[model samples]
Target chain A: MDINTVNSLSYEDFVQVFGNVVEKCPLISAAVWSRRPFTGLSDIEANIAEFIDSLPRSGQEGILRCHPDLAGKDLQSGTLTRESNEEQSQAGMTALDSVEISRMRHLNSEYKKRFGFPFVICARMNDKEAILRQLSERLTNERETELERAIDEVKKICRLRLYNLVLSDTQNKL
Target chain B: MDINTVNSLSYEDFVQVFGNVVEKCPLISAAVWSRRPFTGLSDIEANIAEFIDSLPRSGQEGILRCHPDLAGKDLQSGTLTRESNEEQSQAGMTALDSVEISRMRHLNSEYKKRFGFPFVICARMNDKEAILRQLSERLTNERETELERAIDEVKKICRLRLYNLVLSDTQNKL
Candidate 1:
C-alpha cells in the first residue's frame, strides 16, 4: 500500500492493519489513527515515536513491560504474536540447548526484578550471542539510562515492524 | 552465555557467544555484527523443512538453491546467510503488492529455470493472511500418490535463481 492507500483507509481498518506493531499495544496505533495523511513513512514513524516519547515514565514502563522476555516460557507456550515469534527465532532462540534456555531464564528473572520491566531490544536486528552479551552488560547500568535505552530499542522495533506492515517496498532501497 | 553465566558476558563477548544458530549459515551473524548484541536480548531461528526423502540433486545447486528471496534480491546479490532471515521475513513478502514486484518475478525466476528444486510448503505453520488461505488448498495435494504435485511448484521457481529459511520456538506448540 502507498501513501494514498493509507490516506484512504478508515480509522478502524488502519488500526486493524497496524495495531500489533508495538506488540499488543494497539492503543498506540489507535491513537495514531486520527493523525493520518502522513507525508511518508518517516513522518508517520516520527509521529509514533513522539507519541511514545510523550508518555510518562510509568506509561513508558508499561510499554516496556508489554514485551515478552527473550527465551521466556511465553515463547515455548505459543503466546507470542507472529512478529514476536519470528523476531525471537531470528535471534536464534529457537534451538537453544536445554542448558542455554535455563541460563537465559535466570538472567531474565534477575533483570525484571531490578528494572521493573522486561529487557527490551529489537531481536530481529541482532543475533543470539550479541543479545546475550548486552543482557549481561545492561544489568550493571544505572536505572535511568537502562530505562531510556529500552524505550529507544522499542522505537527501533516499532520502526521495523511498521516497515513490515506497510512500507517494505519504499524502505529507502534495501 | 551458559546456564551459569550469560549474565556475566561483556556485551561484545556475549555477542560472539550466541551468534550462529543454523549449522550452515555464519555470515548472518557477521552481517549483523555492528548492530550490537542489543543491550537487552539471544535469538536465533531458521526454517528448512527437512523432508529430505532423497539424495542430492546437482550438489552445487543444493547450496545456492537452499536460500529463499531476501526481499527478492539476496538471490541476485548473493547475500542471504542467516537461514531465518528468509523465512521470518517470508510473511512480510506476502503483502508486497503485485506492482511492487511481479507475481512470477515474485515467484522467483532463476530457481526454476535451472534447477528442479521445489519450494516446500511450511506456509501451514505461519500466520500471515496470505499464508493461511493457501494452506488448506495445498492440503488437497496428493503428496504420496502424486509426488509430481510437489515438484510442480519447484520447477516454476527455478527460472528466478530460486528462493528462501527460519524456525519458530513456540511453533512446535502451535
Candidate 2:
C-alpha cells in the first residue's frame, strides 16, 4: 500500500497492514496510524519512538519480551513474524554454522534466564558476529540497564522496519 | 477455541486463531473453517484432509513450503509460530547439542537442495534422534516419492495440531 492508502485506512485495516512490520508489537502501528500522511519516514519514526518510550516500563518490557531471542528457536521452523524472518535472514544470522549456533543458543538462554526476557537487537544493523559479541557482553548488565538497552534496540529495529515499509510502498507507487 | 466456538468464528477470525496452527498454511484453517460444527475431531480432520488433497499440485507445494526445515534456522531465533515451537521443542529438536545441530544443518540443506523446500516431519510424535535418522534416510528418495512423503508427514502434523488445539480448548472449559 502507498502512503496515501496507508494514511486513509481504518485503524483496524491499518493495523493489519502495518502491524507486524515491527514484529509482535502491533500496538505501535495502531497508535501511530492516526497521524497519517506522515511527511515521510521521519515523521513516522519520531512518533513511534515517542509512543514506545512513553509506554510504562512494564509495557516496554512486555513488548521487548514479544520479540524472539536472536538466533533462537524461531528459525528452525520458519515461524518468525514476516519482518523478523526477513531481517534475521538478511543479516545471515539465520543460517549460522554449528559453532556460532551453539554459542548463540547458550548466550540466549543465559541472557533470558538472567533478565527474564529474550535478548533484542536491530537485526538490520548488525551481522551475526556483532550480535554474538553484544549478546555475550550484555549478559553482565544489571536488569534495569539491560532493559533500557533492549528498548533502545527495539526503537532502532522499528525505525528500520518503518523505513523499509515506506520505501517499499513508495517504490511500488512508482 | 472449542469446536463449537470454532464453528462460529468468521473465516478470517478462525484463520487468525488456527492459521499457522498448521505452521505456515493459514489457508488450511480458512478452507476448513466453513465445514465446522464438527461432531468430533475426526470430522474436522477429514475435511482438512479433503481440502488439502483436493488442491492442485502447486497449491500443495505452496503449503508444504510454509513449513520450516526440521532443526532449521527458525529454532535459533525463537521465531516459530507458537504451535510449531511447542511441537519441535517437545520432540527435543529445538535444543539439540552441537553435534546433532551440525548434523541437522547438513541434512536440512541437503534435503532442501534436492527437494526444493524444507524437510518437515511431525515432531510431536517422534524424538529428535528418530527425526535425524529419518532426515538422513529420506535424503536418498526420488523427488516424486519425497514430495509424497513430505505431504503425508504434513497431514500427520495437521492432525496432531488440530487435536492439541481442540483438546486444549476442551480442557479450558472444564
Candidate 3:
C-alpha cells in the first residue's frame, strides 16, 4: 500500500481491487467493472478518464444504482460496513436521528416510485437537506434526463472513491 | 511534461495553470484550488482526496459551478491550445447541433434564473439530449439542495480534469 507499492501494482492487481469493491457495490461496479485491463498505470488512468467522460450520457438510472437506500430506523442499523457507516455519520445522517430517519424513509419511498431505484448521490459529502433538495428537484425531471444526470453523478462518486482507495492504501503502507 | 516534471511542479506552477483557466473563466474562481507539493504523488493525491472530502454539504450547486455556462462554450474551447481543443472535441460536445445549441442557450437562461449561475455539468462526456434531461430534472430541486449537488459535481469534474492534466503530462513526457 505504500505509494510505490500502489504505483507498482500490476494492472490485474489493480483491477482486482476494483473488482472486489465493485462486486460489493454494483453501482460502482457497473460504472467501472466492465472495462478491460489497461497496458499500464497511464492506460488505467486513461480508462478512468474515459469512464468519467462517459458518465453524463448514461443518465439517472446509472447514478441511483451507486447508493444504498437511506438508513431505516427500524431496519438493522449495522448492515453497512464500519467504514460506510462512519462515513454516513460524518455526513450527519446518524441512525438515531428520528427526524432524519423518517425523512429518509419517506424520501426513499418517493424516490423509488419516481425513479425506480434508491435515491443515489455520493453521500460521503452530502447532508440531509442537500439530499432532500436533489431528490425533490430530480423527481421533476423526465426519466431519461434524470437517469443521465444520475449516472454522471455516480461516475463522480466512483472517481472520488477510487482516489480514496488508492490514497488509503498509500497511507496504510506508510 | 513528464511524471517527474508534473511531480516536480511547484504549488506556484499549479496555481499558474489554475489561474490561467480561472482568468479565462471567472465562474470557477470562487472555488478554492490547491496542490500540495512534495507529498509525493500520494500526498498530492491525498490533497485531492481531502479537498473532495471537504466539499459543500449539498451536491447540486457544487456540481453546477464546475461547469461553464453551456452557451459559453467558447470559454474552455477558446482557451484550449489546438491539441487540447482536439482532445475536448473527441470527448464530444464541441459542435453542438442546432437544436441542442438552442436548448443549451435556453437552459442557460433558465438555470441562471433558478440558481443564480448557469447550469453546470461536466459536459465533456454528455451529448445534447443527456444534458437537457439533467437540466430539466435538476430544475425541480429546492435551491439549497441543488447548490450542494452542484458543488459535489464540480469537485468531481475538477478531480477528473486534474487526473487528465497529470496523465496527459505523463503521456507527453513518454
Candidate 4:
C-alpha cells in the first residue's frame, strides 16, 4: 500500500497492517493511528519515532527487551516472527555456521547481561560479518551510548519496514 | 483447515499456520511438523505436548515469558498478536474498566515478581473473573507447583488454539 492507501485505513485495519513496523511493539502503530492523514510514509515514520523517543527510559528499554536475540534460539528453532525471519534472512543470519551461531549467542548473552537488552542491529542493512563486528565493538561502549545507538538501529529497521510496505514498487527512497 | 489439509502442509506453511498455537513458542510447532502424517488433530496436539514436556525448566520458563500479561500493555494498546487479541476479547479482557485493569496489572506484576514469568491463563476458557481468581490463588503456590500449573495452562491454551485453527467448522472436538 502507498501513502494514500495507508491514510485511508480504518484504525483497526491500520494497526493490523502496520502493527509490527516497530517489531513486537505494535503499541507504537496503535498510538500513531490517531496521527493519520500522514503526508507520506515519513510522516508516519516521524510519528512513530516521536512516540518511541517520548517514552521514559524504562519504556525504551522495554522496547528493546521485546526484540529476540539475533540468530539466537528463535532463529534456530524456526520461530522468529515473519518480519524478523525475513529481515534476518536478508542479512544471511539463517546461513550462520554452528561456530558463528554460538559466537553470536555468546555475544548476545553478554550484551544482555551488561545492558539488560539484546544487541539489536538493522539486520536488513548489514551482513552477518558487519553484524558480528559491530556486536563485538559495541560491547565496549557505555550503557547510555549503546542504548542510543540501539534505538537508532530500531528506527532504521522501522524505516525499512515502512518503506517495504508502503513504497515497494516506487522508486522513492527514505 | 481439516486434519487432511493440516497433514499435507509443507513444513514452512505448517509452522507459519500453527507457530503461535502455544503463544509465542513457535518452536513447538516447528518441531512437531517433523512428526506429520498425523492420524488427526489430537495427534498434532500430542506431539506439541510431548515437545513442550521435553523442555528443561529454563526452556519452559522461557515459553511462559513469551506470553504477554493479561489486560496488560499489549492488550490496552492493541499490540496483542491476533490470536491473543481474540482470545483475550473472548474472555472479556478488552472490556476491563480502568479499576479492573489496574487490579489485573498489579496482580500480574506481583505474580511475575514471584515467578519471573507472566501469569498465563487459557483466556479462551475463562472470563475475567476466573482469571483474576486463579491469579490470586496461584500466587500462594510454591515455585515448582506454579511452574507445572502454568505449563498446564499453556497446554490448554495451545489445545484451544489448535482446535480453533483446524476444526472451526466441524462438531468433532479435541
- Give the C-alpha interface root-mean-square deviation per candidate: 19.1, 16.4, 16.5, 13.9
Candidate 4 chain B — worst ten consecutive residues by lDDT sum?
Answer: B54-63
Q: Pick the candidate with the highest TM-score.
A: 4
**Best candidate (score: DockQ):** 4
Cα displacement (Å) at residue B87, model 1: 41
Q: Order of candidates by lDDT, top first?
A: 4, 2, 1, 3
lDDT tens digits by residue: candidate 2, A38-81: 76567777877776666545456556656766776677777778
Cα lDDT tens digits for candidate 1, A1-174: 787777777544665687777776665665565467788777778877876776545556656766778888678898888999999998898988888888788888789778767788899888887888898889888999998999899999999998887756563432
Task: Give the whole-model CA lDDT for all candidates, comma-separated.
Answer: 0.55, 0.72, 0.49, 0.80
Question: Is model 2 an incorrect, acceptable, medium or high docking prediction?
Answer: incorrect
Q: By DockQ thresholds, what CAPRI class is model 4?
A: incorrect
Give a tens-digit lDDT track for model 3, residues B36-62. Answer: 233343444445445334423322222
Model 4 chain A: lowest-lDDT 10 consecutive positions: A54-63
TM-scores of the models, in the order given: 0.49, 0.50, 0.39, 0.53
Which regions of candidate 1 fall more than 4 Å away from where they truly are? A168-174, B1-174
Candidate 3, residues A1-174: lDDT per residue as tens digits?
Answer: 444564454332444465323212322222332343334334444554464443333222322332456564312556665445655666666644677667677877776677654566666778767876787788788877776676555555555555666566544543
- lDDT (tens digit, per residue) of candidate 2 on B83-125: 7888888999867999999999998888867765678888988
True contacts kept of each: 0.00, 0.00, 0.00, 0.00
* Alpha carbon lDDT at A163, candidate 3: 60
The better candidate by DockQ, 1 or 4, is: 4
Query: How many Å off is the CA of A34 in candidate 2?
Result: 40
Which of 3 and 4 is ahead in TM-score?
A: 4
- Model 4 bad stretches (over 4 Å): A169-174, B1-174
- Candidate order by TM-score, decreasing, is 4, 2, 1, 3
